[model samples]
Target: MFKKIKYGKIEVRSQTLVLFSAIYFAFILNLAFWRYILGHVQINNFANFFFIISTAISVVSAFYIFFNLIIVPFAAKPLLSLLLLFSSIVNYMMFSLNVFVDKDMMRNVFETTTAEAWDLVTIPGVIWVLVLGILPAVFLIRIKIKYLSFKKELFSRIKLIAIAIILLLIQVPFFYKSYASFVRNHSEIGHLLNTSNYIDGTIKEIKTRLNSNHKFIRLDENPSLVLNDDGAKTVFILMIGETARDANFSLGGYKRNTNPFLRKEDVIYFKDVKSCGTSTAYSVPCMFSNLTRSGFSQSKARYMENVLDLIKRAGYDVIWQENDEGCKHVCDRVTIENMLERKNSPYCRTGYCLDEVFLEGLDKKLMNIKKDTVIIMHTMGSHGPAYYKRYPDRFKIFKPTCDTSDIQNCSRESVINTYDNTIVYTDYIISSVINTLKKFPNLESGLLYVSDHGESLGEKNLYLHGMPYAIAPEEQKTVPMILWMSDNMKALDYINYSCLKSKAKDNDYSHDVIFHSLLSILEVKTISYNPDLDIFRSCRTRRFPY
Candidate 1:
């Protein structure tokens, strides 16, 4: 049978090999193509390139193994295409499951699957989950399995299809999330290498450069500008917000009265603050890095050092508190990120908990601190899917909660209202923190709040965060930036406040300034600090040393 399947001069197996090779070759080309999409040189590390190559090899090898072990014996069967299509479905299923399971990865923080997932009581999501898992697997099986029959019957296939439907009923979520992440990460290349995750490896290289650039000021390296009346106490708090939109902020001058509290306060608010990107996956890492959003995504991670790491080294008492599942590895090196976060701990919440949960332990943590403090509170404000999850029950300021993840079921107004309510809660939390600073007698206290990234509440076809940078909406790119400093808290001889205010108020600054701004405020010396990178440092004389 294999002998008759020759085309011109080539045998069937040779033909399959050639075709498979071509697909994988295209995968390699896609790696280069990804760089073009970003319009930058992809200076990926050795591991990144290795990842691409390995992924392509793994997929091809899997196909080969399946074909040789199972499909070759069933060559008489004509169910190959159906099998391939089925596998695509399963891929989607696994992808969904993975995303939902890895709380740190996606919307993994839910205590329970949202009510929207249920279709009538039958659970339409079960059907979806199965389809996501079963289809691709069926295709893969069909491709490699050897089907033999003296005479094949067309009508008999009906039973097979039914069987497939039944199988899909059992395994959707697992299949969906796995495939989705694979594609989302590498689909830009449209190649088989996605199975290997080379794209992420490349992304990591650039992250190093970004982390290296994350600091502009270190507190211990320089004395606090704002001194208490007694002149013996010191205090500093860095409030890292999560997914708060600039357009929704009242202080940032969003037409909506989103941030009424900040607007009223005498805070140094940046009217034109721009996040490096639209998604937390990209933005959080970028915000803590030296590079701008564009620059960080392409640079090498090995070359950078995060601001937090430096603060700890500078002998300041570093603390990391969180009300969110938050970013992975980003906070790994911080002295305090572990003590405060509930990620892997027995914290009742998953990806998101209440803002009050964060506010609950706020006072005891900060009062009576010894050395200068670099406290970073990673909030769970405004994460999507269940937009209402981030705020407390009382702070459900937005009416008609669009608690369902399915946006089509909810009106745009309902979703925004719920999200804004969360933002309002975030503002209240910030206010409480600021108020705490005012009362604390020890140190000059300051609050710098920047959201990890903005989100999409169903604008155009964009559902949530993580839209590719190329097509991200303005809503996703713009973010709220507020610096609340007490009257006495000013860099004594460092730089001009008016200049910093003017620069920050404009939307030109990206995550690049975060490092320098922190360094300037903390007085930590770092070689990576660039006045040009700092929105406030261009006028400042002394530069920070990393």
Candidate 2:
């Protein structure tokens, strides 16, 4: 009754404890991968929670495996590992998130509503789930095939002590790994908060940040150059947009003549403009901040001066008009954005609003201001899944539309046509703004149009944008930028139109150049202005200054 066992009829004793430990270890590995996917990567607590679940699972599993492995012969699969494998898979599913996955909501999870639209138009978390999922089951099945055996006397009560020790030892590593990951994760969040200030100052030095701190800075005895023209009567509107591709625009030279009305206006179209980012969350913040595309990746956005604050300081009236529903506050410090963004209505939709809504009060708002005013008209141009949602009902130019929110149900061609239709509408919207600006007899009005980021339209079977910037496709990088000057502004010596025209078609332009170009056009000067970095300085070449 002390120690007697047979290993598949081989006379040597079977070390069932080691085999049980290996199977248990494999299951823990499987579950650990799942925990990472569900965005539930707590430290020891998560591991411990799963371990407790595994223990409960093992209770039922022990009985099943014992009968299946010993009493009932030829099961081919290991009982312990099978429980471990299946349980681990279920746990992974529990941790799955929709943020990193594409359309995973069709699975009908308990956690359907997300803080993000289309979980914020980002990739769903299921990509990792599938890759890490099936291997555990396969490995566990193989382990059972290779390790099934019987130990006759060692199944006694006193031997239970050794079995308990074996389970605990194998379980410790998984618990420790989870603990380490959690510690690292929390520290990263802490770092993001800490670095926000340092980054803000550096970006402000270049005049590319939102200028949230500019008010506090202006309070200083020696302040930066201020945007307040002190009643010179100037206005500026910065249209912070989202996920708009250059190809969709009629003004940007799309074959569809999407910007049909824009062509008749006096706008300088920078046909070869490129975007710094592919996603709105990443790009919009970066564009407003002074950080370069290369610098944005290695650092956090918290410490930069967004462009709006600089505009405020240079003495221009600043306003943020937003149509993008999911847009974040990159210009928060400079001016509070007036919500052109629509609330829920029959025509009002989720994730974004129509370009028409943005135009609704623009003319009225323009007359109210006497300062050299600036207005940012944020557009919901071509932000997808429901690309047709960005435009009004009348803009549905393409016949046989796929105007529903469920993107997959619609054909790819239908989805693209609907998206391009929104581009067509965007073309009209920009032209209308140009016309409104022309009404001021004494005003030297100009408009600088830039997209927050570009989008992907069915390239390599990829539906949208935001493939890490390093691998972002051309459709997501090439943006269409145009600067329109009223005849009054150019003819009256407010700007050198011929010089701007020379550089408009150059391929080396980027959002980086906008920081300096805006200041050049507006006539603002700061101590930190680098002639080489500023777009209008004589030292800068015909190409890009940034």
Candidate 3:
């Protein structure tokens, strides 16, 4: 049985080598896939054996199905070995991180900069890749093969395929109901299969991005605006908040006073607002683009300028102050100040600048603009698992906070406490921005605070954001939005001040409103602007203020 047998150019040591290799590879390499199915599918006493046999058959049959479809006929032994080794590496990463590979994660991989890549490098990651990927790859590359005739090789391959199909066919009648139910109930299990997840995701990402580039229809070649500007210079500030969920916001009626400062102010809090996507990489650009959430296309968004660009075209000086990684290319043509690069600033510590750092020289930046201006402050708000690092020591009001970046290691209570503290700190930051804007009373100033997306706090064993939007929990989609305009700013004739009071919490809104609302408020007239999607539409008496 230990003897080597040859079939064409391929060599197998006994037929047992082929059978054992197929079973071993399926079971070992797909541990994550198996674990997911086992946890999700119900197993009654009588159905237990049925599920087990069905799963085993599915794995073995899938292996042969793909092998005969691709590897057997097309790939030589060496190439097939390389592909297997590469897949093992991907499996190790996914299993260790508890991440599901989907289009968004693939987008993240392609969009990841060098600085962001460091977060993924860890001791466990290194260990898993070495044990699961490199060792297997070395063995495969070093192995030798014996040869046989082409006819014999084809016969052997067909025989193996036939056997796998027969076994799968036999299981269908006995366990068809259980198998169908499991697959239907836990559809995501297919994405966890080794190599298939990333392969499918990558292909999608590439196709979407490629098609997305040429789809942009310019909003306005030369935008014209009618300012409700009285004697004061119109100043509009947009705060792009990060990873903040409405469930944690005190303004949204959360149990905690996470937004104590903002609550004290006249913030028109929008209660029912959902994000376009679950990741910053997707949400940032989407929110700023002049496209409705329902009508939005990633392919089209990448090509056009956003609300900021339209505001600039309307003759306002646009400045972007970034404390996060970036404004996701929305600020490319605008004047940008990198707050995180201000290493000498007090807000800079531990290779990251606190959200307050975004305000360091805001007053001076404002002074340079003689014309009406729009300033965007993109903050690193409540981004975890380093929740403790987000706020200053004094703002660590939530006691026994989770200090470690590894959130799962901490108790769920501690995670919530720490995360809430970050929200409180964010409140202070927003209030501070409002206070600073107040100092320039002569300027017609207003601040609109909206988060790119929301976060999940260990709900149902899910620790973070970026679950596919279609199936994501409400906690990951619902975000907090606040608008505060100075009395002078609200006096803009086109803005119906009554609407802000009436629609503060009653209506359902989304990132769809951001684009149209900004254009309406700024009084930028363009063909792309749709009043129907604007939250302020009912309040506006006219498109332009005389």
* Candidate number of the best TM-score: 3
Give the runs in model 1 whose Cα sits over 4 Å from its true position: 1-124, 131-233, 297-299, 337-351, 491-499, 538-546
Please provide, for model 3 over 1-546, each residue's C-alpha lDDT reduced to its tens digit, 9 standing for 90 to 100: 333335423343423435554665677777877777777765777587677867877787866656554444234455556656767766765564455778887887777655445544555656766776667566544443332466886787788788888888887778877767766866666678876787798999898976665755667898777753456688889998889999999889999888889888888889979999988888999999876677676667778888888888888889898877677778988999888678788888755788988677778765655788898888889876567878889998987888866666678899999999999989999998898888887788899999988988978677778777877889889999999888777765456666876786679999989998888777777777887877777776664433
Task: Return the clash pairs for model 3, or none.
Answer: 8-148, 212-299
> Between prediction 2 and prediction 3, which has the larger TM-score?
3
Which portions of model 3 miss their true places by more than 4 Å? 1-25, 45-48, 64-98, 138-155, 169-185, 213-216, 349-351, 493-499, 540-546
Q: What is candidate 2's lDDT per residue for 155-247, written digit by digit as tens?
A: 542264445455555664556665466546533221111112123334443453344243322211221433333333454445555676877
Question: Poorest 10 consecutive residues of model 2 by lDDT?
Answer: 97-106
Of 2 and 3, which scores higher on lDDT? 3
lDDT of 3 at 60: 74
Scored against the true structure, residue 152 in model 2 reaches a CA lDDT of 43
What C-alpha RMSD separates each model from the true structure? 13.1, 13.9, 4.0
CA lDDT of every candidate: 0.55, 0.54, 0.77
**Residue 429 of candidate 3: its Cα lDDT?**
92
| TM-score attained by model 1 | 0.63
In candidate 2, how many Å is residue 277 off?
1.3
Candidate 2 achieves a global lDDT of 0.54
Residue 270 of candidate 1: its Cα lDDT? 77
